[model samples]
Target: MKETPSANKSPPKDDPRIDALIRGYAHLSEQVEVLTEQVKIQKHQVDDLTVDAILAEFHQKQERKTHADSPTPYGRTPPEPAEKEEAPKHLQPEKPHRKRQGLKLAGNIVFYSALVFLIISALFIRTTSNGSPRSLAGFTGMVVLSGSMQAEIPKGSLVIAQQVDPKTLQIGDDITFMANPTTTVTHRIIGIIEDYEDTGQRAFQTQGIMNDEPDAQPVPAVNVVGKVIFHSEVLGQIAGFMGQYWLFILFAAAVVIGLTVILKRIYQKEPKQTAH
Candidate 1:
């Protein structure tokens, strides 16, 4: 057989087919480069648009915030945050009320003290039907039944006298003494008679202020009761009235106690009512 061209022989260097393959590969590479450049440009454009949108959104938000912070039109202001409210008058503690309560408490103390004093004084004072002077605790209480010392110590006046040494008695001093076994007399000493009848006893020459002459007899120092210290007409009348109507004292005390209780209850309830 004739030897045909070797099946594995190399092609010629200037073969048209090889040239065509190289040209096609070059064109494909050029197309890929253009497509990659277009992709890069599109991505840059998208990034720019996104940044502009974000900036616009931020500006709009800032404008809205500024509008909200600004005062309203026509000099009308925006509503401010609400201030804390004060407590109601009734709910709030009042200094004046506290002071008033203190004053009231003081007044109650004074009132009760006065009432106790009056009761004690009424109990200690003794009244007699014969109007004789009574002695207690070195003091004497005498009711003047006569007008012998009118204006100075009128009738129906109560005289308080203090016991003192007879030797210390002075002229022009008012003294109370026993004129007889049952009769008691209060008079001013005009003179002091010393060593009466040589008995070494002192006597007091007595006379009423309103009388025109001295007493019929000199008052012996032994008969002296006390020296007059205080006198009151109103107290004497009150004492006489109470002696006659002793039930009034009980009624008055009961009334005072009842009123005090009612007042205390009222004061106690007032705060509770005000709180409600």
Candidate 2:
């Protein structure tokens, strides 16, 4: 047979072809590593661009919302805030009822004030007697038990008397005085006896308007109580009536006050109960 190359030749250790093949493989691997690094860099760049775009879009949306919420310019009115919804009628307070309650309270106050006034007036008028007449604010209240003065100061009249100086008392002036230790009398001063009984004190000669003769005793200056100022028959009747029924009136007043307190408490709690 002719000489031929062996089918599986063992290449030499210094073969240029094998060296070139190994060098090419190392260069290809380096190029592949470089391409992978470039792909990673490009991916990072794309991610950053996407994040910036999203951030920009979000900022734009926020700005649009803020602009919409801002007030409008001069020509246009700003949007009004929504009104708070009212509660249902069943849950709402009764205004008319409250108004009625207020009126009732005012009426009660007026009524109580009048009642108190009448009570005080009655007490002042009824308690003043011949034995011990009381004076208040320089004025004495007296209930006339006789018709001595007849037309001027009738029987059963409430008389208001003002204290005056004995020197100021004049003839023809109606006066009240202590006639005795335990008796009081109202009469007219007809004359003044200066230096009566040599006591150096002046005295008044007094007599009833309807009497024919003057009183036997002279009214000394010290016995003079006051000058009669005013008198009223209607007030005397009312005073007499109140004197008899004052205890009953006081009891009724207490009952009314208690009821008012209870009603006020109920009125105050009604709104709280409705709210709950």
The per-model lDDT (C-alpha) reads 0.83, 0.84
Instruction: Report residue 194 deviation for candidate 2 (angstroms).
Output: 3.2
Evaluated against the true structure, the overall lDDT of model 2 is 0.84
State TM-scores per candidate: 0.53, 0.54
lDDT tens string, model 2, 193-275?
Answer: 88999999889999999889999999999998899989889887776666678777667777877898899899888855455
Which sections of candidate 2 miss by over 4 Å?
1-110, 126-130, 245-248, 254-258, 272-276
Clashing pairs in 1: none
Model 1 agreement with the true structure over 1-276: per-residue lDDT tens digits: 888888889899999999999999999999999999999999999999999999999997776667677766786655554467999989988789889999989998998887774564454355445545556688877678898899589998877888899999999999999898678888999999999878799999999999999999999988898999999999888766654555667579779989979997998888554553
Q: Worst lDDT window (10 residues) for model 2? A: 122-131
| Best model number under lDDT | 2
